[model samples]
Target chain A: MVSLYFLLFYINILLIGCVLVYIYKLRKLIGFQLGMTISMVAGGFFAFTSGIIFIYVYPFHFLPVTIAATLLGMAVGSIFGSFFDYQTLLSGYSNGLMMGMMSPMVGAVAKNSFLFLSFAECLFFASLLLVLSSARQT
Target chain B: MILYLYTMLGINILIPAVLFLTMKKKRKLFTDRYGMTISFSASLIFSLSLGTALFFTLPVSFSVLIFISAAAGSIIGLSYGILITFQSLIIGLFNGTIGSLMGTMLAAVIIDPSLCGLPSQFSTLLDRNIILITLFLTLLSLLSSLLLRFSYRV
Candidate 1:
């Protein structure tokens, strides 16, 4: 059977990616091509870091760290929202950091399998963003 | 024990996250203080753990792992937002290589793992002064990397 945690994690990632893409679409800051690329590349980093941060701050002292991580995520998100129009790497890193702050990390394995899974999340987000943006443009 | 394992898990996940973030080509962040701080912390954490692991495993595979970690760390450090100087890359690379060797020694004593290499060879390598010096250098390298920002962009 598929791991329940894995399912939740992917679904969470997909929902966040789509919502953010929609917001970006409304902002009218980034072009379709750049948005797709950023979502794909930035999404992977964002997911993996989210998983790592989740692993670090879960179960114990979750409240304090979660709050702090939330602030950090907002900082990251704000940075990205401001700079997406200009196309900057710092903005992407901050966005990745934000996404990392928001994701849940299931304490299942310590292997690198999660790395590939995170990339898959990125690709999934990228394609979905591409489709959504393309639809809106047309 | 659990902390180390958590950190191991954390680093494995964090490395790729940082790597993908660095793939973007921007001309501003790395040169800035905030960006450098993140890279410095990530490099130090990544190299130290891998280095520590190398000491215990002494497996040929660990060496390859060290190389990959170092490469990824440098790649991320050098390219994060703004292209950082070559000196920063060198500092990061140095941290990874030295950290691994030193970590090997520290782990041999702390975890005292029986694997990695011949007991006799390890014993000789783990001489008293070696431990002190390794500890000193590791700290020094970490501090210096964070403080110094050489401006040679690759």
Candidate 2:
């Protein structure tokens, strides 16, 4: 069961990586405002999912989980934000940081509910899809 | 350990205060968009970090922590927004409040992980974890302030 959850976590990460690459390729077409929105959604969504999945996996190591999630959020936000402008970067970074810090706690609260986890994963996928579609339109 | 936490909190407060003062010195030079960004990010980061620190440093008093943090966040936002326009002020106020609320919630969970149904740790481990998080948040606050300062160049 734990392995299954771990696999799901990695798959989500892989999907995020793919999205990042796609966004990078389309960086030229997106406007500054859209870029900030894209980066914020990506960073916050990924951080929230990863944080939840991680906490659900290892219910013990709270400290490390929080640290990892926060860093992950910061890294994703900055990378995505860097594609646009300094203000975009700042917006993404702060949003990601805030979400990252809050996520593991939310995961912890959800406890052993696989249903909630699945819903979170689905939301992430749906949001990513929206981001890609919007980017393509741009 | 309590003393150490208080010291960290003071440092956390000071970093942003310095940043706010430095930014204040040049409010006349800021462009409109830049002013908004500064107001938004500064207040958000300030409220979040301070809220977390207060929750961790004080005793387990959720009501007090929440009230203080929310007020602190709104004030920070208002201060930054006051430098700009009505729109920026509103943005600052909302973001600051949300950010502080989040920080308080996170701190609550950290202090008592059992709130999430996970088995809680021993006191020593919990203290150590609190210290580590505090240090990490301080570093984050510093990095963000540095980023804000460098925005002038970019």
Identify the leading candidate in terms of TM-score: 2
Indicate the worst ten consecutive residues by lDDT in candidate 1 chain A: A103-112
DockQ of each: 0.01, 0.81
lDDT of 2: 0.87
Displacement of residue A61 (Cα, Å) in model 2 is 1.3
Residue B17, candidate 2: Cα error in Å is: 1.2
Structure candidate 1, residue pairs in collision: A50-A100, B30-B82, B51-B100, B55-B104, B85-B152, B86-B152
In model 2, the clashing pairs are none
Residue-level lDDT for A97 in candidate 2: 88
lDDT of the candidates, in the order given: 0.43, 0.87
* Consecutive 10-residue window with the lowest summed lDDT within model 2 chain A: A103-112
Candidate 2 chain B weakest lDDT stretch, 10 residues: B56-65
For model 2, how does the per-residue alpha-carbon lDDT over A1-138 read when each residue is reduced to its tens digit? 889988998898899889989998989889998998998999999899999988988899988999899999989999999998999999889888888888888888887799999999999999999999999997
Considering just the first chain, candidate 2 attains a TM-score of 0.96
Q: How accurate is candidate 1 locally (lDDT)?
A: 0.43
Best by DockQ: 2
